[model samples]
Target chain A: MCTTCGCGQGEGRIEGDEHPHVHEDGGGTVHSHAHAHDHAQGPGQRRMVQIERNLLEKNDAFAKINREQFVQKGIFVLNLVSSPGSGKTTLLTATIDRLKPRIPIAVIEGDQQTTHDADRIRATGVPAIQINTGKGCHLDAHMVGHAAERLNLPQDSVLMIENVGNLVCPSAFDLGEAHKVVILSVTEGEDKPLKYPDMFAAADVLLLNKVDLLPYLEFDVDKCLDFARRVNPRLKVIRTSATTGEGLEAWVEWIEVGAHSAKVIRGEALSSPPCRA
Target chain B: MSLMEGMLRIVEENARDQGFGHVRTVILEIGKLAGVEVEALRFAFEAVADGSIAEGAALQIEEPPGLGWCVECEKESPVESRYDPCPLCGKVPLNITGGTQMRVMALDVE
Candidate 1:
C-alpha cells in the first residue's frame, strides 16, 4: 500500500469517473450510493503525446547520487551479483571475517524475502542490513540509496552490497558500486557466460567460486574463463573457494587494494576538486 | 517487465501533465540489445500497465538493430551482442554505439 496516497498497487482506483446508484425498498426507505468509473472510451478521444525518455534514466539518476556519496565518504563499495546458490553469501561471510579485524566494514544484503543472509553477516560481528525487495526481481539504485541512509557506514570502510541472486535483471541495474563482482560457481555450467552474455559483459570482475570442487566436477575452469573473456575482454577474474579458504586471501587483498585506492583517490579529490565530480 | 514498468510510469506521468483522461496506446522504441524479449514485453504489458492510467492500454514496440563502433575499423556496423566480434575487422572488443535502449517514445492518450 502506498503511504502518501492510498492508491496502492493491485487495487484499481477510478480517479476521474464515477458510477452512481440508488434504490428504494418498498418500506419508504431510500438509499443512494456511488462508485467511481465511466467505461465509455471512444476512439476519437485518444491523442498522441511524445515522451522519448530512457527507461533506466530514473534508476541511473539515483545511482549517480549514491556514487557521489560513496566517493565523498571514500567507501569501497562492491556490488556482488550472481545466480542463486552461487555461494555469494558464504564468500561474503568468509571475506568479512578475514578483513573485519583490519578495516571497518558494513554490508547491505538483498534478497526477495528474509534476513537470513544479514543474520549470517551479523554473526561475524559487522553491521549488516537486509533489504527485502518484495515482488522486485532486482535491486534498483533508489532502494540501495535508502538502505545506505540507515547503514551508518564509517569513513574509509568497505561496503559490500550483496545483490539479489539473479544474473539477468541485476546486470542492467547499477547500485553505484566501485566494482560489480560476478560470482560463478564450478557447479554451474561453463557455458553460462555465453548463454547470459549481458551479465558477463556488464561485470567488472568475474569470480569463479567453489574452485575446490573443480576436481570432483566435470566443469572446465579454463573454458569458463575463456568464455567470460570472450564476452568482456576487460574482465578481471579470480578463482576462490569460500568453504576451503582457498583464494580467500587473494579476494581480501583485492578488496583491500580497492579500499585503499578509494581512500587515496577521495583524498586527492578533496585537495583538488575532481575533474568531473 | 521492469523496463515496461519504467516506461509505463513515464507514459502515465505524461498523460497527467497533458491533462489527458486515459491512455489508449504506448509506443516504445526498444533496441535489439536492450535485453528485453519482444514477446515477453507484449505479455508483461498486460500486468504492469494494470491499475494505472495506462490500464488496458495497447503497447506498440519498434525494434532497432544493434549498432556497434569498431575501434579498429573506425566504422559503425550492426552486431547482435557485445560477444560478437566486429564484422569489419573481427576485433575482440567493439564499442557499442547504439541499441541496448528501452525508451518511451509517444503515447496515445485521451
Candidate 2:
C-alpha cells in the first residue's frame, strides 16, 4: 500500500506527479485523502468497470478485413520477416525472379526509412510499394490495407510483403497474409529461434537462408532445426541460399500451391453466394 | 508503444460509453508467454497515458503463468519458457495450453 494518498495499490505509480491526493482543506494544514483503493471496489463510490479485451483487438479487426479482401481477390499474400542482413531482400528478389513470369506479382516493402527495397523490387519488372514506418518498428494491417488499395492487386496474384528486418515486432503485427515466412540465416546464431521464440512460434514457415556459407562457419544446422521445432512443431523449414540458388525451386513451388488454392477458393466463392449467418 | 495507444483507446471508448468522468486505475492481464516486456510496457504507459483521460491512472499488470499440455504425461503443467519440457515426463515438445494472452481486464473509474 502507498503510504501517501493510497491512490494506487502497491504497484501503480503516478508518472511525474508525487503528491497524488493531498488537499489543503482551505487551511494551513495539508493532508492526504483516505480512500479505499484495494483489490475490491472501494467505498468512495468509485466504479469498477469490467472490460476484458485484448490489446491487439483493434489490429486483429483490421487484419480480418484485410484477410477477407485478400481471399476475395485470390491474392496469395506472404509476410516475410527476418533480422537485419538475414537475406530477406536477396531471397525475395530471387523468388520474385522465378514467380513473376508465371503469376502477377506485387511487393510491399517495409523499412524505417527508405524506398530502396521497393526500388529493387520494381527493377524486377513488377509493381512494388514502399511503406516507410518512420520511427515505427513494424508494419500493421491498417498500413497494408491502404497499400493494397494503392497497388490495385490483380486476381490470382502473389503479394509478397517484405516486412521490416526485425524479428521481434513483426511477429506481433499480422498483415492478413496467408502465411508468415521467417528467414533465419546461417550467418547468425543457431540459437536465434530459442532467443526469439515468439517469432518462431508465430511463423508458419522458416526459410533458413544463406546455407552456402554453412561449411565455413560453426553454425549448427541440426541444432538450429531442433530448436525451431521445439518452439513450433508445425514450422515448415526450407534450407535456402539466394547466391547458389539452392532452395528457390521449392520456395517457388510452395508459393504456387498457395496461389492456386486461393484462386480456386475465389472461383468457388464467385460461383456461389456467401452463406449468411 | 502502440499497445499502450491501444490501451488508452480502449479506456477512452469505455469512458465515453459508460459516462465516466475520470479513470483512476487500469488493470491489465499479461501472460508470461505473451512475448511482451512488462517493464517496458509499464515504463511506456506513463508517457502514453499522459494528458489523456487516463493520465495519473495507476497501471496494474497481472501476469498468468505459462501452461503446456504434455503428450507423454497427458496432463497440463506449469512452464517458465517455451523450450521447457514437461515436468512430469521429459517430452521434447509439449503443446501450449495457456499464458499467451495480453488484455485489459478491468478499470477503476470515478
Candidate 3:
C-alpha cells in the first residue's frame, strides 16, 4: 500500500516486479503478484530521455559571464573579424598610435601561427598577446579565457581580440566582446556581404578599409555599402585607408566614442544603452 | 549487411564492456560547414546501433551556427564556407571561426 497518492497496487507498482502488493478499499482487499512468464520484449526496449539543449549554449553562457566581467572591469572589448592581409594589423597599429595619448588600448591577436601581429602591436607600445590556433579554424571561449588571464588587461583600457583569419568559424563562438567589427577592404569585391551574409548580419560596425586604393582598384564603394546594408540594415559602415591615414580620424573618433560610452555604461551612469542609443 | 552487422556487433560488445544495460539517448553536434552529411551520420548510427545497447536509443543532432573572423578588420563574422569573404569587410582570406566541429556533447544513460 502506497501512503502518498493512495492509489491501488496495479496503478502504483511498475511492471515486472516480483513482489506482490495488497490494496485495501472500502469494499475489500485486492492482491496482485508478478507473473512467471517472460514478458514480450520489443527489439529496442531501452528508454531514452529527449533533452533539447543547444550545443553553443555552454559557449554563450561563458561569453555572457565574460561580458559581465568586462563590464565590471569597466573595459571596452571589441572582436575584430576579417580576412588575412585585409590590413587589421596596420589599422590596429595606426589606431593605437592615434589613440594612445588619450585612451589606453590592448590587443589579443589570434592566428594560426605567429607572434608577428602581436610584435607589431608591441611596437606601438601597447600590450598584446598572440594566440596561435594551430590547425583550428576558430577560437573558442577557452582560448579567450586563457588570453584574458595572460593579458592582465587594465581596468579602464579597451581590449581588442583579433580572431583567427577566417570568416566562418569564429562568429559562432563568442569571446565576450562588446562589439563585433567587420573590416572590408577595397581589394575585395562588393558582393562579399551577399556571399557571407551571416558575418555581415552579426557585425555592429562595417569598416571599409584601404579606401586610399579605391582609385587604383575596381572596387565599388557604393555597391559594397549597398550590399552590406542589404544584409545588415543597422550595420554602421566606416571607410578608412591605413596606408594614407585617410578617414582614420573618423575611425579613431568612433573608437573614442565607443570607449567613452563603454565607461559610462559600465559605471551605470549611462541612461541609454550603448548599442541602441 | 555484413559490414553493418560487424559494426553493430562491435557496438554491442563495446556497450556490454562499458556495463551499459541500454543506452537511453545519444546527442551529436554537427557543424554546418564541417563537410559531414547529416543523413549519412544518421544512417551510420542506425546501422551500427541496430542490436546494441543503443538499439532503441534516440539520436539527437544539433547544428551550431558557423562564424569567421576577418583579420584585416579585426572583426569576427558568422560564415558558412571556407571560400566566403568577410561579410562586413568583403575581403577574402578570412580566418575561419566555427561550423566545422563534430563532437558528442552529451548522452543520457540509465
Best by TM-score: 2
Query: lDDT tens digits, residues A1-277, model 3?
Result: 3332232342111112243222211111121121223334434434433333443544465577678778867788899998777888898899889999988888888876667888899999988877655545555554565467567877777998888776765666677998889998888878888777667767899889998888889888888887877656678988888889988899889888888877887778345465522
Assess each model's interface with DockQ, reporting 2 decimals per model.
0.48, 0.33, 0.06
| Candidate 1 segments exceeding 4 Å error | A1-46, A272-277
C-alpha positional error of residue A51 in candidate 1 after TM-score superposition, expressed in Å: 1.6
lDDT tens digits, residue span A1-277, model 2? 3342232321111112243221211110112223322234232458999999988876687688899889999999999999999999889999999998899999988886668889998999899988766556777776677678778899999999998888887898888999999999999999999999989999999999999999899999999999999999999999999999999999999999999999999999889987665
What order do you get sorting by TM-score, best first? 2, 1, 3
For candidate 3, what is the lDDT?
Answer: 0.67
Candidate 1 scores an fnat of 0.64
How much DockQ does model 3 earn?
0.06
TM per candidate, chain B = 0.89, 0.96, 0.79
List, residue by residue over B1-110, the lDDT tens digit for candidate 2: 76787787788777766777678999999999989999999987998788887999999999999999998788999999888888888886788888988899999998
- Candidate 2 Cα outliers beyond 4 Å, as residue runs: A1-45, A275-277
Instruction: For candidate 1, list the clashing residue pairs, or say none.
Output: A17-A37, A18-A37
How many backbone overlaps does candidate 2 show?
0
Whole-model lDDT, candidate 1? 0.78
DockQ value for model 2: 0.33
Q: Write one digit per residue (lDDT tens) for candidate 1, span B1-110.
A: 66766776576566545667788888999999877789988987877777877888888999998888887889999988867788977886677778888888998877
